[model samples]
Target: MVEIDPADNTAPPAGGKRFAPLWEPPPAPTRGRPARVNRTQIVDAAVAIADERGLDAVSMRSVARALGVGTMTLYSHVPSRDHLIDAMIDRAYADFALPDPDLPWRTALETYARGYFSLLRSHSWLLTVNTWRMPLAPHVFDADEAAFRILVDTGLTANQVVETIGIVRQAVSGFARAAAAEIADERDQGTDYEAYWSAQTDFWENTFDPARYPTMTRLWTMGAFDDAATPFDLRIGALLDTIELLIERAGGSGTAVPSFDECVRMSGPDPAGCADVDTADA
Candidate 1:
């Protein structure tokens, strides 16, 4: 959750900074004939290319070619290929609309986590991007802030909330990476899971001694890895259950905290309780 100053355009020193600059919208076209394209269009075209092909296919020239623009004109909208990648990541985050914060804390968290997991699955290439080089874009921060709001009301300290978020994010990323890799492997091999597993089982049974690998053989015989969805379901449930236990350990939930929707409604020119809740200690 490293924060980047939106105004800082200079790239971070190599291997020193953990994040890049937060993405900002490109400036409006000069007053004259309306410009044919904008940053959003350029980003969308780049994302489509990456989605169909892969991240390596996304370059300034490729994006411009897709958009029917010159490479230099594309550069004017997005300064570099790295900058275009930052926009693509942010756009993915923006697609996951924030869940209703009025739901119970656990419910809200489940909604958010599932949405994030699905987003990564859809854009499997995102798992290949170097996360340390990516900045906390506005949409990404919005999702994080929403989660923070929910956890803060559950009687956890600011530090605890931050720690919990770190755990949740790591879990989601790890799961997504495994899932995406399995998908890509299946596609490349042109084989379904059952076929792949059957081949592996045949080889193992033929080569390995049954007595030496009794437990492994027993599990394989019983079809332990048969269902693809069972593992995901079990793991997601365990993670959420663990968070619920942590909330209880942190002195249980507070009754006075307002729902996120309520806080927004109450936040007028003078943000009464909203500001206090945002900065309050456990």
Candidate 2:
């Protein structure tokens, strides 16, 4: 559900010009034929399907079914699947509470990231959706705008701000994809990440060569595989530190950002947990 950037919106979208249909009030409509279906309902239906069965399960038809409306009636609200997907993507952002305008760049950005990640986790479909597409919906734009402002406040040029946003967004995307894959596989097995990782640790302990991987061996010895540490914040904090360095390097004023490697490698959960998780490309 990539969107066109409003800032770069140059002309009508790649469709032949079509006239807006004339509007007519229904003659004293009864409760049977509702005059309107709120946009929130459409988005809520989409979100419900995404949360329950993942994004692919979300279709206009499914949404209509969820809404107890005729499929054709859905078109009156969401003109196309693409359009519906657009709304769905933006609607997820609406769940994110944007940063306080008065907060420092770092605190605001961190808050934004937390909220964004929360939404991604809550709406797993977002993990599969493309982020490069420009956002058109007001809520999506508002979030991006909030991020851009933080970057600018950090003293980054507009170009730098844009690039930084792309980088951080990729970090979020990477984590979300990882989460989605983990959840998808777990759902099929009726288990969770911790359980799957525990199984992985048992397998690795049996097969991994201590001679070939000394670091892994030491980590294993340290009970890194056991319920000793949750690495989520450690990794996220490391990424923030890396980004802070990048910011300092660019200039004293701009926000720093992290590469996917910095985010994943530093913030990555224990290797023992993902030991059973397939690393091979699917």
Q: Which candidate gets the maximum lDDT versus the true structure?
A: 1
lDDT of 1 by residue, 68-122 (tens): 8776776556666666777788888787756697989888877877777887877
Cα lDDT tens digits for candidate 2, 35-106? 456556876898888888877777777787888876667666555666666677777878888889899877
- lDDT of model 2, residue 102: 92
RMSD of 1: 6.9
Query: Which regions of candidate 1 fall more than 4 Å away from where they truly are?
Result: 1-27, 31-33, 203-234, 252-282
Model 2 worst lDDT run, 10 consecutive residues: 17-26
Tell me each candidate's TM-score: 0.73, 0.69
The TM-score that candidate 2 achieves is 0.69
Candidate 1: how many backbone clashes? Answer: 0
Global lDDT of each candidate:
0.70, 0.65
The runs of at least 3 residues in candidate 2 whose Cα sits more than 4 Å from the true structure, single-residue gaps closed, are 1-36, 200-206, 218-234, 252-282
lDDT, model 1: 0.70
Minimum summed lDDT over a 10-residue window in model 1 is located at 1-10
